[model samples]
Target chain A: MRASSRTPLTTRLWAFGVWSVVIFFVLNLLGLIGSVVTSSFATRWLGTWFPAGFTWKWYFAAWDEFQLGDVLWVTFEVVGWVVVISGLLGVPAAYALARREFPGKRFVVLLLLLPLLVPSVTYGIPLATVLYKVGFGGSLVGVILANLVPTVPFVVLVMIPFIEQIDPRIESAARVFGANTFKVFVYVLVPILMPGVLAALLLVLVRTIAMFELTFLVAGPGSQTLVVALYYAVFAAGVRAVQSIDAMAVVYMVTTLIWLIIALRFVNPTQIVARAKRDTSH
Target chain B: MTDRGPTLTQRLRARGLDGVTLLVLPCVLAIIALFIYPFLYGLWLSFQPKDGTTMGNYDRFFREPFLYKTIWTTLKISIPVTILNLLLAVPIAFRVRLMKHQRLLTTILVLPITLGTVLVAEGMLFYFGPQGWFSRTVMALGLMDHAPSITHGYWGVFLSLLITGFPFTFLLTLSYVTGIEPALEQAAATLGAGPAARFREIFLPLLLPGLAITFCLSFVQAYSVLPSAILVGDPANTTRVISIAAYQAAFEDYDYSLASAIAMIMGAVQLVVVAAILGARTLVYRGPVAAAKG
Candidate 1:
């Protein structure tokens, strides 16, 4: 692919233009994030290129003011349940969809895709209302259940390709060797499917952490995730120091960034797109 | 073998519904309870207004300019953002697909996804606000006489959408662009096709369908601009998106029926756009390309 020496001037110029845009975007992005990080540690920042002074007060202030410890705990609990539950429900469904030919399979695929294709907010309001009616709204359990609406389908979709790529003969071989369904799943399938399962759940972890709409609609005072809490902080802006808000923002960034880095190790970003293409093309 | 009755699993397997297929039942049931049931309930609720009249909520929605106009407001922001993201992503993805080390650049591009819309909005408030560094820098460099008010308004929400949506669109586009065989382009080059010809004739055709899908997905993301729209935008006026309208109806007014009606409208609009794009895709090239590698 490195035929740069013989490449035409126009091609090189086009490449340069594209890279220029990318660099400009990356720089601005870094600058934006840098501004938040800097302000978080700043003692005072107002109409200046640099803060007048730097301090750690805002971190403590934000931690205390936002009750971030509780928020973080809630966030962790919701994300953990979402990841584990979605995996248990979605992986088996994915395996079935990949291996079996059954009636209404296309309909089942469409049903799964509907939650994903529809924007969350469209479903979230009604779902929140229903949860409220069922008396689960405004709590951690409601948040977890609300989030699963999307994540479960997401897990199913992501795992199908992984399950499909595994040769069915392996499962058949295990069956022929007198391994029962449960035994094959435990001994044979789990080990083989571990990587895909890990990747899916990790991506789910990242997504649930960042998921705003569903959680926002369903969460109560004590049930807010970090992202939703950040929203409320930014919403009621003047009640807190700007620096403190920035500190909270930075904390949210770090939380998701950590998982994002780990998720990248397991799953390529392009594979997400590849999966989307495969799902849509059919 | 005949002496023993068929096992339960064996009986199920004969009916094309084996024990394995039953594994799917839990997920299907959960989706029905959480997603589908609520959707149907919402549909029913929309018809049963406080006034006890079917279509009352939708009627109220269309009658009120503040409520109905949100559809237009949402489309205004989402359509343009989706188009702009696609326009930027295609060229960049095309360029990146040829590079040896694509991972680093893609990773950098996708960083904003983890930051979520709230952080992006917060960052934009500081970076693009009147007193923000971007304005301060531009003024210091004499690029402009005064700092631009890019945040807390229409453009603020637009920029936020662009910043967050671009990475997703680019990643998807890159996957599609990479899926096409490089050999096809080399073959075109061998046939005396220039760079522009190769792209126009070869890449563009293969990319159209994927681009359409990318447009729909990205558009949906932008369409549901709730947090950023409220934080970065003038939600009372210019950037009152449909999601915000539904949110206000449900929470502030304690009106679930109206909220559900608005939600239904939002879903319908998105479905129309997605269906239209997918339908247009059928008019374009339709063939098996090699799956994405690396």
Candidate 2:
């Protein structure tokens, strides 16, 4: 390579600018989160770079005051049900889409995409309206049902690419060995599909937990998720210690961060973005 | 001899194997019952009037100018955020391609998004509030005696949206940038193409479609901002987006019909924007890889 081919000074400066932006972005995020973590533990932090003192009492206060025990339990219940139910319904549909060919298949796929393509509030208000009409609105059932609309399709779409990667001959070979359809799916298919299924379900678990719009719209007095509860804790017409609210935010951050880390183990972040596109558009 | 008719067991197995209805009926039923039915129901409800007149909710929405102001409010925030994300994302995404630890950097960047909008907003309040370090630092620097508040106006909500949106757009752009074969850049370099020239000629064409789609997706995501706007912005209506309007129309006012109408309008605007972007997408030349795959 010729030294004359070196990057020009302006190009070097431009590259420097780009790197600075990256550093700034990282520092900004760390500052935001670090401040919250610090504040949550601070005894008193009034306009200082470092907190005056650190304590753990705010966590206990946030716990008892926010009824976090119940909120966590409800979040788990909602996420668990949505994950399991979407898996049960979605895996088979994905299997069929991966393996079968039939009329109007593209149409069915498009129908599935509708729930995901349209913003949740667009469909959420209507869905909640029907749930309220049916005496299910503001209930845990409504939240679960509402979340399932987007999640089930998500499972089906994410699973489709995974399922398509497996050779169809394996299932056919099982059938040739006198195995029934159920046996082929249970013994032959499940082992091969386990990784994909885990990935899909884990991602679904993360999504359901972080999903705010649908849950917020349908959740009732007794059915508030952690996110909705945190929203109220911050915005509800009452004065509360900032540290306590920050504590609750930390809890949310940790919970979702854990799930997302687990999800990243099985899937590339870009693949997730790509999946969103393929799942929605064609 | 006449061919023997298929037996019941054979018929059942056949149905299980290839019967689309048997295989797909449950999911189809679920989508219809849960998704389609509700959307249609919302549509019907939007049109229904409590006073027994059609279009009443829409009429009321149109009659009150303050109610429809949310459209302008949402667009003002969403458009700028989308533009800012694209501008920052393109440069950062290009630089990231040069980094060896691209995946780790990406993961670190995307970590905040996993926290979701609510936590991010709450964190922003403490970190960017009047008495927060940002304000305090500026005060300490003697720029002003009083600390400036970022968590109580358009700037607060805009920053939150930026925080949430930047990583998403960056991730999408990175994928698209990396999807372009490095061999192309190397070839351009060997041919004496400078960085800018190579990017303009080789990368820009390839990245445009993906960027369009990314912009649309990110814009839609930002446009539907509710929690951040309400949590961090001037709640007196500075950042009162359309979604907030819909929420209030239903829950606070007990006017589900009006709420549904506002939601319908929001959906329409979003759809129009998305459709236009997608339409523009068709005009751009998709490369051989995309074309062959499609």
Candidate 3:
């Protein structure tokens, strides 16, 4: 307060510096993505500020050449099953963990944390090994199961705080009215917990769709997700058009970005990370 | 008519293993069978002898300098990314938190995370390659006579890592920064603490622990770099991270034991860094609650 004379000068300088950084960051992001978008439609981009000409031919070529029809279908199937199964297993577990107290609770919480905290690749190799040994690794079932390792725990952790926020007295009131266990859960708990459930499932869907390491290991020709397919298009032996590969990358980006936007509507990404941190630090 | 005996469900409920506990059973079973079993199986596989009675895989990894160099390569990329990300994130988070339109800024920053590492890497090839706009612009600006190919070397991969890593590190730092009650800073200012004084006396001490935590988490993430390294960098070895080594060992070499051994070592290194950071975090002077109240 006493330094009012200096405040104006410092604030002006500070604002200038801050906006510079913001503009720089945004431009860098735009440049990288913009190049891909422009090239995907470019007839030719050699030594030009913009493409020589634009066309939608590359999109069609990419779709046909990459068999993205099957890949997209497989991606949907894997993401869908993973979302449903993770929810089915995770929501109930979150409820139990939230509403009830038991011995070894700390240990159980740590068990849940391990999958999330560690990198997926660390466990993915072994998981893939075991899956292949059992004749499941190269199929859709393997990809879904492998993804569930991290995602199910993600659902449980995200749902726990939501479940905990609800007052236990609501359930007790339902119980006192002679509603049985099943009735109390469905008629009373589900309505109140719907928001949390939706948030958990949506985030799980985004994560499964984007999950790379585990999915990469277990996925085969018939089971490749969009991400794995994109990897192959980039690295696998081939002399494909640069524009076509960029087109596929664009497809993957658009697919993931759409779900992420939807998920953000349900919950802030900050809250999800912060809550998980808080849960673990305990 | 008088069959009023307690049913099986009621009996189970009478014990603490009620419906709630049963709710937890599927998760527990799945974790054990899928997560725990596979991890243990991998560990066992890592020890299998090619001949009959030797720890051959572990020995091979240590004996082959090429295989062991991956640890250093992983650290080389991870440490710089971690440090640079923090340096960039802290200042940006401070400034961004002050903005009235933080939601928009956060969305702009977080958009890349949705585009996974693979897409980001693929985009880098087009954006940073020799004939790409970046190089063309540099040449046009007379910065160089020709467009130096940046996308096929260490710099290219590093640039991509920054693109992906910055957003994540920034998000974590933003949450931590925002969590600190603004009122505390205001109170310090009212007490005649100048800007520097307020930062040093009030903010720095509190932010240190949080910064350490962020560093550890971010480092763990960067340390696991895989796809970008392979796709963009000279995979003949320049950017071959441990994950890539492990992957090639298993798939290309068909040496399952060797791959498992590399993976285990990778986990060990990550755990060591994490533990050390956690220890340092606990040593700092901490308040009753570090996070800002919701």
Write the number of the candidate with greater lDDT, choosing between 1 and 3: 1
Question: Pick by DockQ: which candidate is best?
Answer: 1
Pick out the ten consecutive residues of candidate 3 chain A with the lowest summed lDDT: A273-282
lDDT string for model 3 (B1-294, tens) is: 898999888766565556677687798788888888888888898888465555887787788889889888888888898899998888788888888878877887777776878878888887777777777878888999987877867877788888888888888888888777789899998999887788788777878877887888788778888888889888777888899999998889878888888888888889998888778777876565544443
| Candidate 2 C-alpha lDDT tens digits along B1-294 | 797899776775555546433566788789999988887888888888687799788888778878878888899999899999999999888888888877888888777666788888888887787867677777888998887867878999899999988888889888778777688889998999988899888888777788888988788779989889999998568898889899888889888888888889999999998888878877776555463121
DockQ of 3: 0.55
If chain B of candidate 1 is superposed on the true chain B, what is its TM-score?
0.93
Model 1: per-residue Cα lDDT over B1-94, one tens digit each = 3678888878878767977888899999999999999999999999989998898998898999999999999999999999999999999987
List ranges where model 1 is wrong by over 4 Å. Answer: A1-6, A272-282, B1-15, B286-294
TM-score chain B for all models.
0.93, 0.88, 0.89
RMSD vs true structure, all candidates: 2.9, 3.4, 3.8
Report backbone clashes per prediction: 0, 0, 0
**Higher-TM-score candidate among 1 and 2?**
1
* DockQ, each predicted model: 0.67, 0.55, 0.55
Deviation in Å, model 3, residue B288 alpha carbon: 3.3
Sort by lDDT, top down from the best = 1, 2, 3
Provide all candidates' interface root-mean-square deviations.
2.0, 2.9, 2.2
Which one wins on TM-score?
Answer: 1
Better structure of 2 and 3 per lDDT: 2
